[model samples]
Target chain A: MRNIIVTGGSRGLGLGIAERLATDGFQVIAIARSQTEVFDAAAQRVKAAGRGALQFHAADLADIEAIPALVKAIRKEFGALYGLVNNAGLGTGGLLSGMNDAAMAQLLRLNIHSPIALTKYVTRTMMTQKGGRIVNISSIVASNGFNALSVYSATKAALVGFTKSLARELGPLEITVNAVAPGFVDTELTSGLGEAGYDKIVRRSALRRMAEVEDVGSAVAFLFSDGARNITGTVVTVDAGNTA
Target chain B: MTSRMADNTEPSVRSTILDEIHRIAALHNKQLAPLTDALPLMESGLDSLCVAVLVASLDDALELDPFAEDENLAFPVTLGDFIQLYENAAA
Candidate 1:
């Protein structure tokens, strides 16, 4: 079976992507800080598909020094890897003047730096195998300048830029690289927005509603499928036409 | 960059890439380190922005894209492999 790794897989969009791939016939390695109910729900999805298995590894993706060793362990256990979803990220909000260097540093490290480092190692192995896929979970905030999200937007924008170029570099190997930019989904990350804030976002969207987690997960699953062979270096936004 | 390939082209290209590498490393605030063929490019302390710039510069200068055709290429891990990639493309 093909092996795939999903960072931030315990909850949010990462769990959705992991479960979707599992049901679609790929073994998934879920990495997150801790196990969650969503992770167990992912297992049920895998079982419903009648094939593939789910494994969880709890790690702080922010602790990037351990990534190489994590990759080695995954290789020893699952053999060859064909997919990687760099979905691990944190959202920070504050006025530019109020934001401290430490907060900016943490946001940059987790959102932008760690994924690229992980991708570097994973891409090397994929090259040896002659093919693979990489999908980065970017945010619509990267494109639209959201209030109080200046630093967060900057980091996400960087990820989008990296995805576009790396796709070109890896195209020769049939290893596609892409990013999925989701707008407001009803995930825990957005819960802090409160009901009024949530409704305001939904009204702004052309579709008049926030997206379900499945919408973004399905997009990720499509990128990994055979039909998406020619798609690369682009962002698939799954925000109910919110960005439109 | 407009110069034609010549006997001196390889060395000039190598040094130019080296200069760009140093520029990028410093831009990212990474500690200056020695550049050697065996030094891992990622671990050389260049971040994604730095690596992306270096790769794009090589593409513009060399103009031989191994990824453009049916050519099969391995991912370059070290400085040597990256330079060798352009060298192989040139050949």
Candidate 2:
């Protein structure tokens, strides 16, 4: 039973990823600040089937300084960590010029600093084990620009670079790192856009439909599978050809 | 070595540092000669990535990272200097 940590796994795309991995027989430690009723139900269903285990770990990932101790505690309880899904992030969409400095700082802290700090400690365990998988949840907007998402897009773009360089650095240890770039996933993160906003996005996509949370989940699952053992340092786009 | 020993009485810190270096070297498939206090880390065949893994691994084992403590501290050039950083910080 491999231990996989899925940050922000209480809901949204993170929940989808957690459920998918758990169903695939991976012991998932879902880290989120709070647990949702939906998340609890899903964990129950997954565990009842005896497919895999889902354990929730409440944490405020934005507290970057506490990450090392957090990682240490996770490892102490769960043993060697086999995978990490750096999916916890804040989607702060706003015009850069009007964005408050404090808001920008908070956005950067959660979206950028948290994951990197989390990864730093997690990779130590991976390095010691000589193998692991890392999947970063990036955004399609990282490559394709969007209105009012300048800061959000930049943060996601940073992950792309982080994924590539980290893949290179940890490659010698047989640890593979990759990013999953999803486009217009229908989750709480995008609910703020409302129906008309989604309609516009759906029409723009080649598939004429927004990508599902499960689509991103499956992509992440693939990266962790044996089939993707040789695939690293690249972005696997799950955007229904939105960029095409 | 004197600088490291001066800060702390424990002799095991030196051995722990050596062990981690060798462990990380093996993980990265880098062959290293038996280390001497004056051996240049770069010449020991461990690249920057390997050295990074070593520092991280040491921090995990020893629970402190001297380099991370002070941004202004010069990077250790020799094996002894590297161990001394940990010792001084631990002290």
Candidate 3:
């Protein structure tokens, strides 16, 4: 009954990870604002696997103020969390000159600030417990820049930096903090890009296709597994050789 | 959900909060569609963090605590709903 929290678990990569973790026999507490569908899906997967219970929590990650309270609630309900997956993020795209200052600010708040706050809160609990795994869902754009993805990339880059630094800070406590930088996964976010746009992205990848959400999930699960206990402060790129 | 308070239309308090919401929402590329009532907040693409940013911006502009309690607050799905919330707080 190891407790885990997967933020943005309503769909896409987060839901994929939640489903896999549930099947692996870990009690999963999913966090999302409108995640009823995600919960139903994850529950069915868990039941089919005949392992672990699933709990869904609804919260807006954009509300940075609500994060500490949310973490506290999880601690109260589940005791001590064994793993945390900071997969909740938002995408905002526009030319730099045309983008408004407030949009940039909000993007940073959701993509960077929320994850940092959650990591800070959860790290404290993990410190006291003397064991935990943290996997941050970063973007491939963090390494390779794109035209309209400046703000989004910046936030994810900050996340990668945070992951490395926090790993150092918490490694002595036996808590591993790492990041999974996925390249163009098939999800709601990509669906919004439409067929032509998606094809362009896929062709740019070395594999000539988009990585499935579960591909990223398997990488995240590996990082959280006992075999990865010695791996920390690293960015595992599950980009299907896109960076190579 | 029209009210005498919302209709008062003074730049004093309520209007300032409404203006801030519109400004923030627009910055997020959200449509201020149907600046009237009856929009669900969760569907507007304005998540919890947007609300916090809106509150902070409102605090800076209006210098008040319109976001006093979370219990009484409703997620604003539309421009009108946000304006109504601001008006209720002002009242």
Query: What is the C-alpha DockQ of each candidate?
Result: 0.04, 0.52, 0.02
- lDDT by residue for model 1 (A101-212), tens: 9999999999999999889767766754558999999999989988888999999899999999999888866789999999988988888888898998999999999988
TM-scores, in order shown? 0.73, 0.92, 0.71
- Order candidates by DockQ, high to low: 2, 1, 3
Off by over 4 Å in 1: B1-91
How large is the C-alpha RMSD of every model relative to the true structure? 12.5, 3.8, 16.5
Which residue pairs clash within candidate 2?
Answer: none
lDDT of 1: 0.82
By TM-score, the candidates rank as 2, 1, 3
Better of 1 and 3 by DockQ: 1
**Against the correct fold, how does model 3 do in TM-score?**
0.71
Clashes of each: 0, 0, 6
Q: Comparing 2 and 3 by TM-score, which wins?
A: 2
Q: Model 2, A103-157: lDDT tens per residue?
A: 9999899989999989988998887667999999999999999999999999999
- The structural similarity of chain B in model 1 to the true chain B, as TM-score, is 0.69
Give the lDDT of residue A41 in candidate 3. 67
Candidate lDDT scores, in order, read: 0.82, 0.89, 0.78
If both were scored by lDDT, which would come out higher, candidate 1 or candidate 3?
A: 1
Using TM-score as the measure, the top candidate is: 2
Question: Model 3, A101-209: lDDT tens per residue?
Answer: 9999999998999989888777656654467999999989999987788899999999899999989877766889999999888887777787888888877888888
